[model samples]
Target: MADPKGFMTTPRQDWPRRPVGERVRDWDEVYVPGALLPIISAQADRCMDCGVPFCHEACPLGNLIPEWNDLVSRDDWRAAAERLHATNNFPEFTGRLCPAPCEAGCVLAINQPAVTIKNVEVAIADRAWELGLAPPRPPDRLSGRTVAVVGSGPAGLAAAQQLTRAGHTVAVYEKDDRPGGLMRYGIPEFKMERRHLERRLDQMRAEGTRFRLSTAVGRDVGAAELRSRYDAVVIAAGATAWRELDVPGRELEGIWQAMEYLPLANRVCEGDLEESPLSAEGKHVVIVGGGDTGADCLGTAVRQRAASVTQLDIYGQPGADRDHEVEPWPTYPKIYRLSAAHEEADALGTAPSADADARLFAASTLHFTGDADGRVRELSLVEVDAGRREVPDSTRTLPADLVLLALGFSGPDRGDGLVDQLGLAMEPRGTIARDDGFATNVPGVFAAGDAARGASLIVWAIAEGRSVAAAVDRYLTGSSRLPAPIGPYDRPMVV
Candidate 1:
């Protein structure tokens, strides 16, 4: 346990982010270098020695929150890293990207601010690398079994790493030119640097995990061939079939999906393009979504120097504090919270409203208006009530030279021909159908992550990946020792 009285005496302190003015000018991560290490220990000390740690239950990966918090508070960085890695395959990725539902479940959060779990996790991850605590551990002997992991996202990578460490010859197939999937192309550099991903990839390579990049299964190689070649196949292709806006004039020239826009900006950052042709510079941008993807678009537009930016949320703005009756303790609540991208938009005065953040809640899009050249010019919208029913006399129009639809994804993209070629069963909602053990209808074939679970948080993706790997290992050798955090049907911690 951490300091017994520390929770009562110490207040939570977060790692300071870099200044908005300086951070917006460049594409580096928004964190102040070397700032987290100094403050993380004290923040870790704030973790109570609660008899029941709800934070552990809240995490999809079942991260050892209390154990790591105690280790970190004691300044045992190495042990903290080990305990963190015991459940999570990629602490650094989750530490940075996850919304930290665990914090919401923190025992201290009942009356006080939660311990800085996310910050402590990241500090241990970075310190582990610096202290040589993290090293590639290749298997001592080969199991003579082969596994093919489809996709290079979190789930696929986790599965491949686990199988490789268990002595299986694992090969990861990625259609993209690089590994890391969305982490490489969809996520902006400002959120997380590519170096962290690159180093992890290096470690995987050292551990004998093979990556077959720029290779599309069912296209370059038939799904049948993939199944015939490998003893087992794990499909972690992810849910990338982006939802489309069906409003009128959505086909206008300047309209794009968030995936389309984010990847191009990421390509620019990767030196593949000098500058994005779809740059938001000098344009009035309007994003149509309320999720993290929309905020990502907001940040990217702000960086590109968009004239003005606005994010429309279909639901009404949530209250600043949790509604205890609706969402009690240990349950993740829907409350107003400012994100880094929103902070940047607010600081730069790039949002439509000067006082509030970039988001306009209860706003629903009616249609878009285009110019002479068939380019989007303005957006028509109306305010809505709790049920999304339009309110009377609330129609409005906003100048929108560029419209981005960040409406989230429905399920896995089947355009790659993998699903059709394998005759895989899919749910009505478009996700691949799988059993409790992560097995698809086809024998020796499995599906995990967003491909099977639909779009979800990064932590869930990694958890599913690790779980699928255990099932695959058991199928391959009849017995295995790999850790499986959750089954396919294990739902997230929600009310």
Candidate 2:
């Protein structure tokens, strides 16, 4: 246990963020550099090390939270890193990107603030790398088997790393010019610097995980050829089929899907372009969707010096605290929380919506008005009731030279032809269908992550990756020792 009574004595304090004025000027991560190491140990002490430890149940990766908290509190960073890496393959990625349901389920959060689990996890991961404790662990002997992992996202990377460490010749095929999947192109550099991703890629390469970049599995190489070449295949091509908004004037010159806008901005950061062709500079931007992706667009637009920004959400605004009767403890709650991107938008006075955070809840987009040049000039919206029916006389309009649709993804993109070529079965929700063991209808093939489960958090992706690797190993070598933390159908504790 971290501290028998330290949970009572110490109050939870999270890692501090860089000032908005300074951070908004560049694409660096928002957190203050070199600030976490000092406060992380104290934050780790706040872990009560509960007898039940609901945090474990909340995390999809089944991370050893209490064990590592104790190790961190005792200043055994190396041991803490080992315990953290025991279950989670990419704590750094999750620490930065995940919403941290583990913290919501923390025993301390029953009444008090939860322990700073995310900050502590990131600190341990960063320290592990700095201390040379996270070296590549090449296999002792080759299993004489080969595995092909489609996609370079978290799930595919995790599966490939585990398979490689298990002595299988692992090859990861990616359609993008670089790996890391969305982490490389969809996610902004301000959220998490790509260097963290690059470091992992280097480690994977050192461990003999070969990456086939710009190679679409079903397009460049035939499905039959891949099946005959590799002993096994794992499809982790994440859900990227974006849900479209069927509204009028959606094809205006300045309107773009969140995926399209985010990737182009990311390309600018990647040095592929001197400037984003879809820059939001000097435009009035209205984002239709009040999710993380929408906030990402808001932040990007704010950084691009958008004249004004407004984000609309179909759902009503949630309360500040959890409704105990409804959501209760230990389950992820629907509460109003300010993400870093929203914070930036709020601090910069970019969001001109009803909420202070630049978000207008219970709002539905009706249509867009365009200028004579066929560019979006304004957006029409109306306030809705609980059932999503527009309230009478509540219609309004906002200046919107640029419109971004950040509606969530539906399923894996079918443009690559992998599903059709392999004859993979799909669910009604458009996700690939798999068995309890993560196996697809096609023999010697398995699926995991967003491709099979639809859009979800990064932690779930890593968990699915680990689980599918174990299942694939068992199929390949008959009874393997790889850990499978969660099954393919495992879900998080959310109301």
Query: What residue runs in model 1 are displaced by over 4 Å at the alpha carbon?
Result: none
Worst 10 residues of 2 by lDDT: 348-357
Q: lDDT of each model, Cα atoms only?
A: 0.92, 0.92
Tens-place lDDT digits, model 2, residues 268-346: 9999999898999999999999898998898888888899989999999999999999999999999999988888888
As for candidate 2, its clashing pairs are: none
lDDT tens readout by residue for model 1, 54-109 = 99889988899989999998999889889998998789999999999999999999
Residue-level lDDT for 30 in candidate 1 = 93
Q: How far is 136's C-alpha from truth in model 1 (Å)?
A: 0.2
The per-residue C-alpha lDDT of model 1 at residue 377 equals 95
Residue pairs in clash, model 1: none
Reference-based TM-score of each model? 0.99, 0.99
